[model samples]
Structure formats: structure tokens, C-alpha cells
Target: MIEAHALIKRYGDRRAVDELSFIVKPGQVTGFLGPNGAGKSTTMRMIVGLDRPTAGTVTVAGRPYREHTAPLCQVGALLEATAVHRGRTARNHLLALAQTHGISSRRVDEVLGLVGLADVARRRAGGFSLGMGQRLGIAAALLGDPAVVILDEPVNGLDPDGVRWLRDLLKGLATEGRTVLVSSHLMSEMAVTAEHLVIIGRGRLLADTTVSDLIDRVGVGSVLVRSPNGADLRDLLVRHGAEVTGVEPGLFQAAGLDAATIGDLALAGGLAVHELTPRRASLEDAYLELTREAVEYR
Candidate 1:
């Protein structure tokens, strides 16, 4: 599990992360979402002890990452796929990381195969493609078999199949009772992969919620009611405090009311209802509405 309390990070005149607090639980995948330069990468760096928090505390498994005896065994992070030695082979990269923590060479080969980098394991990382580089970075992360996994844009350069593989891989890690925190700009992928979300903007915590709860809280959904008695239905619905608008001659859009309530009101007024379809808001819609003001770059 990852716990951060009022975490703050400053760089001279700029406060990149400001008083951000959120808990990432184990046994589930948590998405870390934000706009460009929303301090997501900064926060993730602090979680792994690569950067220090200017104020507040963030701990991995009840202790700061640097304080752990074997940090690699406690947390596996893939912050930058390209932050490797250019001349080193993919296999050497993992081997180098494993050597730091005294991990067996067999484990090194295992992770290489696990990430599907075994075929080109001997190739220099400098010549690898973007997708291949990402795979190598992931292999290094899993080398220690940490209890917590933190990945920043793991699917940055992956193809569709690679993206699907990453989704399943993260889910499998969480199912094993490990804390999985992932950051991505792809909202659609996140909607399917993450059970919970921690969204931030302008270095502040905007939302920490489950996917279902976030959708419900946004509540911008509208119910489309089609009827022969469209005029009468609209009148009755407006009387009940519903905002109604005629999309066309026979179709009406009702806001601030659910489908069941609208249908009930139509029935009581003796209106012939044809269709009562609810147009629910998507995650992208909710995210934009929630973080509209917090967006720094527009």
C-alpha cells in the first residue's frame, strides 16, 4: 500500500506538488491521472525516493522508500524507460539492477522472458525501438519482485497488443495482493484497467475515488424521453423540477431526473412513452469537468 499525507514539493519559485494526499491500496490497480505538467511524475518520484517531498510524508508499506533495507524488494518502479545506459544490452540492464540487491541471475533471465525481451536480450538498448525500450524498463522493474509496483505511462510506446498485455499484467500484479499504481494519459484504457483513481491538477488533489463512484458523483447524465404526448410530458416533467428541452418534434431531453422518475411522471399524465434512454456521461467527460479549472496549460 502507498500512503501520502499532505505531500508537497517545491522547485524554487514553483510548487510542483502542493499538499497532495491520497492512499493507494493493495489488491487493486489505481490510476494516477492528470493533465500535462500536473505533477504526477513528481509525486511518483517522491513515492520511490528519487525526489524528496518539500513538506509532508509519503510511505511505501509504512516506511519511506529510502529507509527500507532493500528498496528494490519493497517497490518496483518504471519512471523512465529511456533512463538506461545507452551501450548496455537489455539483459545487462536487468542484470546490473539485480546485482545491486544481490538478486540471482536466474531471476534476471526470468523477468526478461516475462517481459518478452528474451529474444533481443543481448541487443544494445541504444539501438532498441521505443516499444522495446519500454519492455526492457519493465523487466528491470520486476527484477526485484517488489511488493508495490509504480509505472508511469507503461504503454507510452506499445502497440495495441502490447497495451492489452500491460493491462492484464498490471491486473495480475494487483490480484497477487500487491499495490499497483499506474499513470497514463489514455482515459479509455484507464477506465478498463483501474478500479480506483487518484486524480490531481495544478499539484493539488482533485479527486480520489472509485471509477463507479466518480461517474455517479459527476451525474451529468440525461434521460431522453420520446413520446406521442411530448408536449404534455415536458410540461409535467418541468412541473416536477426537471429541466426539459425538445431535441426535435417528438423527442425530449430531461435533466436533473432519472429515467424511472421521468417514465413514472409520463405514465401519471397519460402520455404514451416510446423510448426512455439514459445518456450516461463517460469517464473523459467527468475528468474534464472535474479538472477544468485546475489545468495549468489550458
Candidate 2:
């Protein structure tokens, strides 16, 4: 479990993260999502003690990361790339980390195998591809067999297969009762991977709820309908106390009315329907709607 209380970070007058607080529960994948420069990275840095918080505090397993006797073993972090000595192998990097925590070399090999880096255990990290580097980073994170995992933009720069692998791995960790905190710009991927989300903007909390709750908070999403009898349908929907918008020449967007009601109205009034569908309500739209007033820079 991870917790942040009134976490705040500032550089001069610019507030990178302000009064942000949230909890990451075990057995769930919690997503940290926001636009570019939304303080996701800064907050993560503060959490793991990579950067100190200006005002507030963050705890991993009820203690700050720096205070832990064996910090790596208590919290596994992949905040940086794996750039070991060009001559040293991947296994050596992990072994060195294991040595720092007084862990055995057997655990190093276990994590190497777990992250599918056993074959390249002898390969120099400098020669590894980006995907391989990411895997090695993951192997290092798992080296301590930590109970809580925090990843910032884990899928960034990764290929499709690697992205899916990371997603599945995070999901698997959460399923096994490990707390997972993943920060990403990929909302669509987050939609599939994260059970709960903490949305922020301009260094403030916009939302802290389940994915479905955030979607529902978009004030009952509507569908875009295009009908030859657009005006007629709009009038009918208006009469039924529904919000209707004439978006184009022959297209109208309707809310407060379901498809069945619209269909029954058109059928009873002899109005021909051209097209109707339950539109996909994107998380981006929901986020934009919620953070429209919270954004600091336009």
C-alpha cells in the first residue's frame, strides 16, 4: 500500500504538484493519469524519495522510502534506465543490487528468469535494445521481490508486444495482492489495465475514483445521431424534455434519452431514422470535461 498526504512540490512560483493525496490499495492497479506536464513524474519522484516534497509526505508501506533499512527490497522502482558498465552483464547489475541489500545471487537469477532475461544474463546492458532495457529494468525491480510496485510511464517507447507484456505483468502483480501504481499518458491502455484512477491537472486533484465512476461523472454521456429527419427528431426529443443539439445539417446529438425511446418516438411519429448508435464515450472526453476549469495554462 502507498499513501500521500497533501503532497506539494514547488519550484519558485510554479507549483508542480499541490495538495495531492491518494491511496493505492493492494490487489488493484491504480493509474495516475493527466496531461503533459501534469506533475505525474514529479509526484512519483517525491514518492520514492528521488525528489523531496516541498510540503507534505508520502509513505510506502507506512514509511518513507529513504528511512527503510533495505529500501530496494521494500519498494521496487524502475524510474531510471539500466545503463551498467558496457563490459558488465545484465546478471551482474542485478547481482550488484542484490549484494547491496545482502540478498543472495539465487534471487537475482530468479528475477532474471522471471523477466525473460535469462538468455541475455551475460549480455552487456549497453548493447541491449530499448525493449531489452525495459525488461532489464523490470528484472531489477523484481530483484527484491517487493510487495509494492510503482512504475512511471512503463509503456513509453515500448513496442506493441512489450506494451501488452507490461500491462499483463502489472495486472498479474495486482491480482496476486501486490499494490501497483502505474502512471501513463496512454488513457486507452489505462482504461483496460487500471481498476482505479487518480486524475490530476495543474497540480491539483481532479478525480480519485474507479474508472466507471469517473465515466459516470461526465453527466450522463450522450449519443451522436444523424437522421434525415434531424429537425423533426430534435423537436420530438425536446418535447420529451431531452437535451438536443443540431450538430450539422442533418445530424443531432441527443442526451437524456435512450435509443429505445428515440426509436419508439420515430416509429410512432412516422419519422424515418437514418442512423443511430451508442457512441463511444472516451476517457479523454471525460477528463477534458472535468479538468476544463482546473488547467493552469489554457
Worst ten in a row by lDDT for model 2: 79-88
Model 1's lDDT to the true fold? 0.92
lDDT of each: 0.92, 0.85
Q: Write the per-residue lDDT of candidate 1 for residues 1-298, one digit (tens) a residue.
A: 9999999999998999999999999999999999999999999999999899999999999999999999989999999999999999988888888888999999999998998888998999999989988888888888899999999999999999999999999999999999999999899999999999999999999999998888887775788999988888888889999988889987988888999998888777888999999988778878888888988885
* Cα distance off (Å), candidate 1, residue 80: 0.8
lDDT (10s digit) by residue, model 2, range 36-120: 7889889988988989999999999999989999888788878766545657799999988899999999999998888778999
The best candidate in terms of lDDT = 1
Off by over 4 Å in 2: 82-87, 219-271, 294-298
The alpha-carbon lDDT assigned to residue 241 of candidate 1 equals 93
Q: For model 1, give the RMSD to the true fold.
A: 3.5
Candidate closest to the true structure, highest TM-score:
1
